[model samples]
Target chain A: MSAVKQFIPLFDRILVSRAVAAAKTKGGIMLPESSQKKLNEGVVVSCGPGAVDADGDVIPVSVSVGDKVLLPEYGGTKLNLDDEEYLLIRDSEILGKFVKVTSE
Target chain B: MSAVKQFIPLFDRILVSRAVAAAKTKGGIMLPESSQKKLNEGVVVSCGPGAVDADGDVIPVSVSVGDKVLLPEYGGTKLNLDDEEYLLIRDSEILGKFVKVTSE
Candidate 1:
């Protein structure tokens, strides 16, 4: 009961929550656990109400909440809730927004 | 042998190929068949090699080769090939690029 949950995303939708795998295996030898699952790189937390245009107007969503997106190992709609497992997705399925690793 | 296939995508990635769901049911009463299994809306054909920046350079990949993308019901990695059943995804998971539905 602690997978982490606090979504919002409604309009443009986007409440990701993955990002947990850092170093499961790379030189180990035990790459079984379902092939390591994979697909982890999110953070946004919430976003939406920005895709309408055509005359309806809206189109905004550029990234804000926390920004760190980069999801696409598969895709949105996974929701679990209390058990934890968010994804939601739709900020155009966000493909880029992770630029803050600078620390030389 | 006609599920439609012709991908290309590579770097920034973007080779959708779904779009094939017009109407299954809504007023009929048949909403079973895996709940219609909705998640279509693609076209982009090919793209990639972009997104490198930070210093590496590149960072190109706004979209090309047909365009008309808009996916994210779950996400990429679901290929099949000759048998059909694509969903490669990546181009930042392409969340928007469809603006040519003029009619009158």
Candidate 2:
């Protein structure tokens, strides 16, 4: 969070860190980087002020910090910050927020 | 516009027709299909009702019908309808509206 704070998103944009593949398999065998699949899931790092309308009213974005979101297969602007890979995407490009399923 | 109405967008989504490269160059030299570069510019054909907030409030989108917009280099769901290619992309992925300058 500290590192992501240095860069802020603007104009209904969001910064996200894509998820990495599992380190080990079900058999507890370590996997190689080449075998790791690039995940479309990401964690919301930061968000910009919501986009303004014709009348100049600011609308709040649906997502917030710490929310997990489903990303479009393509379309994010790749950026490297603090040696970490991040994406600058407009909130509209986000497919949906991954809802956490909590058992009763 | 008649054909685009067959499909409707949802949640800040917009339908756009990507610009096609000219068959002839400024010098009047005809170019082959292989030489055509996919343009990132598009014209807004249709748009979804604005995304609703958690409070269920609908926000109006910035761009309207007939607006020209700059699209991300990559990212948009491609669909073919009535022999025409269109993209379904969130309005956020749109870089900006192409403003027309009228000379007095």
Candidate 3:
């Protein structure tokens, strides 16, 4: 019933929604969109069944849906649906998971 | 005893040696080094123990040493040792395995 459920990833693949553009400077000065370096941050939307082993067994991936992860600058297939863009990256392409730090 | 044994990759990392430059035209005219586009082909020298799970079990990688593979155009840690340069890429960065085809 949701756009997120429209597609299913396969073979250790992960669907991610990219975060908003960076480059919010200290002052009110706004630089052109092309001049700013894009960050590799995103939130996982969906995941595949995981990679297969030598014996044909599926090994589960480390990250899951809703997990915020750091993506590589390059690679990953681009997907466009319903006027929205998404990225399909492999499980190994995920640099690291971003965990929120709450005030203790 | 070989230079390949000098470094051992960790996690899903893989050590690769880039293939030679392309652009050797059929006419045998040599193009300048700067004009040639580099292919993402390489031989796997070594690989890490593979990714771990929540329970901390090591999942064996799909590829092995001595396999010819397609490398990504970017996002690899470069390593230079004893004159030869190598790359440290993740297992997922490998596009696919390259197999030689012979005339039957």
Evaluating just chain A, the predictions reach TM-scores of 0.33, 0.88, 0.81
Best by TM-score: 2
Q: Is the docking of candidate 3 incorrect, acceptable, medium or high quality?
A: incorrect
Tens digit of per-residue lDDT, candidate 2, span B1-104: 35434877998899999898799998999999997887777789989997776667776666788987767778889989889999888876776554544443
Clashing pairs in 3: none
The CA lDDT at A19 in model 1 is 75
lDDT of 3 by residue, B1-104 (tens): 65554788999899998887756676888878886755567789999998876667787766789987766567899899778989899886665554444443
Whole-model Cα lDDT per candidate? 0.64, 0.80, 0.78
Shift of residue A71 alpha carbon in model 2, Å: 25
- In candidate 1, stretches whose alpha carbon ends up further than 4 angstroms from where it belongs are A1-104, B1-30, B33-35, B42-49, B52-56, B63-88, B92-98
At residue B100, candidate 1 shows an lDDT of: 67
TM-scores of all candidate predictions against the true structure: 0.26, 0.51, 0.50
Candidate 2 per-residue C-alpha lDDT over A12-40 given as tens digits, one digit per residue, 9 for 90 to 100? 87889999878899899999989898789
Select the stronger candidate by TM-score from 2 and 3: 2
> iRMS of candidate 2, one decimal?
15.7
TM-score: the better of candidates 1 and 2:
2
After superposition, the stretches of candidate 2 with alpha carbons farther than 4 Å from their true spots are A1-104, B1-5
Model 1 DockQ reads 0.01
